[model samples]
Target chain A: MCTYETSHVAVEGAGKGADGWFPVTEATVYFDHPVAAMAEHTLNLDFLNRARGASARVAVELDATSAYALAQAILERLEAAPPALTGELHRR
Target chain B: MRAMDEAMRAETVKFAGHGGDEIEGYLGQPLGGGPYGAVVVIHHMPGYDRESKEHVRRLAAAGFLALCPNLHVREAPGASPDDAAAAARAAGGVPDDRLVGDVAGAIAHLTALPSASGKVGTIGYCSGGRQSFLAACSLPLDAAVDCYGAFVVEAPPPERGLRMTPLLERAGDLSCPLLGLFGADDQFPAPAETARLGAELTRLGKAHELHTYEGAGHAFFSVDRPAYRVEAAVDGWRRVLAFFGEHLG
Candidate 1:
């Protein structure tokens, strides 16, 4: 039995080829255990279901590994590119 | 001139360009301004719709003489997606080349406006962002700001000219400072592409900066869309305003 942990949900503007414009939001699902992580990909139907809102499109997938890797890479890049604007107002 | 009392004015204006074609756009100016720095705003793929107009109004409030050109004037301003698709199909799936020329025309139109100072810059979103970089390459601009545009990519072969590679190749030719804001999760122009572009700009001795927002996806600057990251959008706008002030002033 595999258990899934929902982490973060993000909504973003995406390019629409012909349907004018629409919103795409994705939820991150984490495996509760290593066995769950290695076993069958968690089907996050609930995440997808919640993503359905006004003019909403949902893309649900289990990327426990890749998503973590990308996040790490982004943090590394930010570390390398020291913040240029420094002030109480500019800090975020 | 009362800051709160100065009403924002927006009007549809047309200009006869050197090419003898009539260029149309929405001009936004502060009601009590005596002359402001000019800014030419380019729309993304959807064209100069409501969002574009609203963006112009915001720029006007920022003390800029802003103009947003309707690149798809031949096509209906608010045409349905089906109609736009049919038109694209009729054109053999080719993106219009006239868009770049239209941007140049907009610059010319702004340069000649009574309330506009000769110093001009450009700001664009998505596809407009790529066009903003293209404007810097082909035209004389004080600065250019591109929001999540695929301006730097390897061009595909002639048989399959990728949608955006030309703008990337032309990045080396940029004469003015260019600021690019991107989202981390955007698949089209991934982080790797942006890193490569920064390297190329460094090699060419050009002044450029690329800022990526964490946990944000494409089109984060668009307030009307779900991808709107309020913090990132506000930060990006501040950076853009700072860039324009530094270069255009």
Candidate 2:
């Protein structure tokens, strides 16, 4: 079934899409039917540059376990960053 | 039955859609046939892709002038189907009123074809399934088929970002005979929900048939997905063809 569940976030980053590197301003996350994945459903993430159009998107579809692991890894790596470079100093 | 040797033509077309905006579509028709019945093939939520176009061709092979409009064309005109689908999803899915208008446009396009028989029906899969029912209720059609459509009797939770409301209330407005095919194990519109819809249609004295295959889950007819169940899909198609034949043949 198409879950139709979605979460959108505004993010500041760069993603490499079909053409090249582009500034990504939004991220949409959902668990639903995949366009090409063999699984019935997957954790889909789309990093998009809305201003650049729909083609300017970097998409990933991962199994639940893999998606959870990747999420943990991202948080771990960010926490391990040096305080000066982690943006914490800038917040101060 | 249609002769296997008959030629068919499939092509991309542009027509005025919702709000009088021009949208793209894929059209398929059997060649050398006189006035064939028409069907508007609505694509699943994944956008109008290769598989959806293939379905249109198959319908043409079955002797109908079939057309599938690009529901996401307004969101991303030149983008790939997947990208366009993603874009549409982020934009909170298609509005119900707009979907009806677009389908009405598709019906007009088909009826205007040289090979049209003046009779038109609608068949849709997944999200398209719900839209098929919506269009049938909102417009006059000869027949309507809803294949594993969700959220007809129940709406998604407010947080899901799918803004559609429960369409069961519109059952009274259905203008055509309706056929619904569902999977017993599908959760979106679970067996209970399907039963509820069936009961409501019956209470309203609408002409309809609702079937749920025991061994099939959602998207049992999706050939490329793991959810595809041959037996269920086969029987479902048989019923679909027969229903359309009775109403539009």
lDDT of 2 by residue, B127-162 (tens): 999999999999999999999899988988787556
Using Cα atoms, each model's DockQ against the true complex is 0.02, 0.76
Clashing pairs in 2: none
Clashing pairs in 1: A12-B227, A13-B227
Predicted model with the maximum DockQ: 2
lDDT digits (tens) for residues A1-92 of candidate 1: 11112345553445342335454444333432111133233332112212333123233333456656766997777766646743422475
Docking class of 2: medium
Please tell me what DockQ candidate 1 reaches.
Answer: 0.02
Among all windows of 10 consecutive residues in model 2 chain A, the one with the lowest summed lDDT is A83-92
Candidate 1 positional error at B102, Å: 0.8
Q: What proportion of the true contacts does each candidate reproduce?
A: 0.00, 0.81
Model 1 stretches astray by more than 4 angstroms: A1-92, B1-6, B77-97, B156-164
CA deviation > 4 Å runs, candidate 2: A88-92, B1-4
